[model samples]
Target: MMTDTDITSPVMDGMGPHGTKVGLLRVLGPAHVWALGVGIVLVGEYMGWNFAVGKGGAYAALIACWFAGILYTCVAMIDSEVTSTVAAAGGQYTQAKHIVGPLMAFNVGLYLVFAYTMLEAANAITAGYLFSVVATMTGHTGDLDQRPFIILVIMFLAWLNYRGVLATLTFNLVITAIAFVAILVLFLSTSGILGGGLMEHAALFEGHELPYGWIGVLAAMHFGLWYYLGIEGTTQAAEEVRSPARALPFGTLAGIMTLLIAATLTWYICSGVLPWEYLGDGVNGSVAPLFDTARLSGSNGLVWLLGFGTLFATLASANGCINDASRAWFAMGRDKYLPGWFGAVHPKYRTPYRSIVFLVPIALIFALGAPLDQVITFSILSGLLEYTFMPLNIIMFRKKWPLNSIKRGYEHPFHPLPALTLLTLCGITFFAVFLGYGTQLVAMIGFYIVVSLWFHFWRYRFVNRGTQFTMPWPKPQGY
Candidate 1:
């Protein structure tokens, strides 16, 4: 255990010798923090969230959006508090290792790596398809295989991560801002502000707005996850932020606000213009709902704008996913949860260069190997598992540390209430996922179970106990 002499701050002072040899560069600010979280989640507004429209109806999708908005509010609150305190690369994984236990930490870290990696794959595939969709929309489509597009996108984004975090996330910030403005512009255009309104709500929702009913809304909650899946990823930047206390809470809170607004506006604009059947009619709903809505407006300018938004949003999402996934993998490796070799940071770039390179092919394989909707489902399921652990992590955090044991950057109010709300929402969303993708859900759980067994039997034996609890905090109440 660390003494007061061991650590004067929350940064991992007890990282042992491995971290001393190399370390992540601390050069990020609140803007980068916002970029990392918003860049990863804004793609949902462009394409993925419409899958919920397919499961329920337009109305059901809207309800699910509000429901998920609440759930993720809790996510933001809890994560902001914990991340402010931990200030580590592993985010919740690091939090779990310190407050929960080794096994739970292992699973949480896997959840981070797999969830973001799968999201990265989905983003690559979507970016590829965005080009093809626009080609056909413009009357110039013969047969765009999208394979090369997917491969190139993945390789380019991985290269960005390989270079440096600042360059990678700076690119994300620019593109993410553009994509967000496109949504805002679309909403304003349709709100009777640009000479005349374009949306015909009466025409779009004529007796078919809620065809599937309440149960459908319940089922729709699964895809509702798309609206805010990676917003919690803001926490992953805790380790690198110039000031974790200020940056984590402020950036994450700002990010969630941005998403909530974008989600509401996207839904209102799309529901007003597009038919429910058209928006939700596919394996995973409309691939480019914003672009399609732009097409319906009969404005070539808006079409080009939203189309670019779709493409840029996907690239940004993939870029942020690589950033977050590599950090999680690198953190696990630093403590021998996976392999010690991956823990090494690049001496020149000071990034987790090894882990970043290793995840590239894994991203490509999942991108090429699965259908877009299936890949998204995989990402969401893995994301859900980590969220189910959130309330527990926070509860244990409060009990173990109580208040005032250490200097916290931020503290969430109505603590147990947020915890209970998060747990209940996660339960409801899990049921929603089960209703739609029961087989995949079961298979995912089974996969985790198998990995858990492996970790217990084999991987746990190699974990360096001294390196795991590297957080510089006083001993817990019970311990």
Candidate 2:
């Protein structure tokens, strides 16, 4: 008889009907795991992004994040189920392969590559921007543009992740501490605004009156949508954690809830002090909205803390992105979709060493050259795609096949409806971003989707031809 904790046990890593071992490790805990998920939601930059969405945008953000949280909270629950069922390393792509088909899985694999890789770059570049923000606030703003600093930040982050998870967790703890303090300082100095006074004095939209239209709502959502981008990422680490059946869903929901509280408070506070009109300038506006808010609010010390916190936050998120992205790459490589090099795990670290190395240069170029708006756009594209597909997989699995046989601790209160609602909302959000940003961005994204599909059929299909990719279909179809 095999023991439960045995690494090779079918109960732990699980086995296909054909008895192939899908090696996976269970190595994470609740606090650290929850921290990773929540951290992405409370990014310090939202203070500015929320403010620009006009006066009403704050309320809209609150509703949006709250509802989005509820929707993705379900997504997390469903993802936890999939995590436990497959217990394999590939995560979303694994489920995509099972539910949709191999070709579709290959497409998801490609999309995950695009999404996470760009996310890594976005984190690094945002860190660099925060660096300049802090420097400027402390009167140290230099002549250099942010690209070089972004490159350096990306390199450092890659090194930290390359070291190991323990080191990465330690770094996360420190950065989270720093971010908490920055938030505390902002609360203290701007406490006056916290007691609903800002709401009491919130001026009507007088400056450059664009008439609060759908454009304003979409712009706000585009920026605010960043808050909820990586909601399911923590669940990807469920296998790496203890009692994931309990911990994964709890951590996922708890993480989003915590960030919702923290982020809402921070956004409201910042708006209370600086107001939205002043936050949107032409030149300086695009760059340092939070720093400017602190200055205008006469809370320079608090502003400095936020600046440093943002730098740290950006780096931490960047590191997490590298970890997730590289793993995704490794997973795909193992499936023989990408080049064989990506599957080569590091001997010492036991991580995706080759994938990380490959990602670094791509990250550097993306970090150093791409503008923030473009980065944000790419992030939106990747994020929304993942968000849409993730929930769809859950619904399809639950309805088509009825995987109720799987043991899942936590579940969304509403079943198929919540998932459907989330998918619809995501579609609407994507359309809104496309309209607000204009056709050029849409065309570029469209071109990317087209090319990615072509690559999947023409390139990856040929590569994985001999390997029979099995998907669990409905009884009428075939499992």
Candidate 3:
């Protein structure tokens, strides 16, 4: 096996066989990373998350979401510290390789790949569904199938990702801005601040607060998780960042704070304007909660705007997912964890063209085959497993490399407390998933086991023959 020094050597700066240099352009700044972080997750503000109301009613869902927000905040803080310190691609996967081991790193990488691609598929599906909704609302539709639209969306994003990171992220900023404005409009309208007169119906429970009681709140945890699920994608851009030590932390923290504000306003306004039961009903569950809310408020203009806005948000999210997932795949390939072809960057665009090309078909398959709820469940489960290791990674980082030795742009307060808290919350979230969807949990475990075994038996030998897995820490003197 290659030693840490071998892996961290300057000579192996992603030089593939035949002396090909596989790398990305460092054209992104803090603002771009921030836009990516928000863009990747803005869809949740428009849809998906409100499905929690279906499980626990409005009040119970709100409580669950609030708790989930806290957990995500702790996670974001810890992740920022790691991102600033390590400043590498692949986010949690890179962090885990240095702090844990290669095996854990492979697992995390695979999990992230699954989570992000599935999220992209989910967003594509949502986009198609929203388009159908818009068509019907506009009184022009006959036998509309969303599957073709989903495929088109996947193809479009794949093409965008292959073009270049600068162009992709520039577009991301514009769409993300539009998405934010869309949410702001919804908040103002539903809050009666826009003279919508919808706040008069703002009742908390109205006899439908907790249909499944506290147990329902547990069930809602996964749905609530949707609100902040993709915020961590910011760290995946470390390799492409202009100054990762400063940009990663600032971008990630800014993204988290913005999502928190948006989540709160979205939940409060949507629940207030519409009956909790109506919002929680199965038919409208995850399909178009926001659109339905605007429709109920007697605003055709608002509904039209939100429908288009939801499409923009979902497309932006799908685009961001491709960007993040391609980087993780690229990182793994560059390190020889998988085939080297996956690590290849476009000569002209400086993006992971191969990985982006690879994921397009997979996303299309997922969009066509799986139900939206199942897609969400699997995505959340995979994400939670990846998240469970982050706190432990933090503790290990501090132990292996003292903080004083590293140049950190940001650090979490209270030392290990945030890590511990995040760990506990992760456990709770995992248990909630198990309690609610036992079969899905079993399937997720089986998937992880299979992937782990494949790595150990087949891929490990190949990767070990050529490359050494190492952390991105500065070498000590005389090493």
Candidate 2 runs further than 4 Å off: 1-25, 44-48, 51-63, 136-142, 193-201, 204-210, 280-283, 286-290, 297-300, 438-441, 452-456, 461-479
Write candidate 1's Cα lDDT for 272-381 as tens digits.
88888778865444568898888888888888999999999999999999999999999888889998898888889888899999999999999999887789999999
Error of 2 at 446 (Å): 3.4
* lDDT of every predicted structure (CA atoms): 0.88, 0.60, 0.80
Query: For model 2, which pairs clash?
Result: 27-240, 28-240
Candidate that scores best on TM-score: 1
Question: Which 10 successive residues of model 2 have the least lDDT summed?
Answer: 1-10
TM-score of 1: 0.96
Ranking by TM-score: 1, 3, 2
The top-ranked prediction according to lDDT is 1
How far residue 74's Cα lies from its native spot in candidate 3, in Å, is 1.3
Candidate 3's C-alpha lDDT? 0.80
Two-way lDDT contest, 2 vs 3, winner: 3
List candidate 1 segments past 4 Å from native. Answer: 1-17, 137-141, 282-285
TM-score of each: 0.96, 0.84, 0.93
lDDT string for model 2 (229-306, tens) is 665667556445656656666777777766666666665565555545555431344344444555566555656666
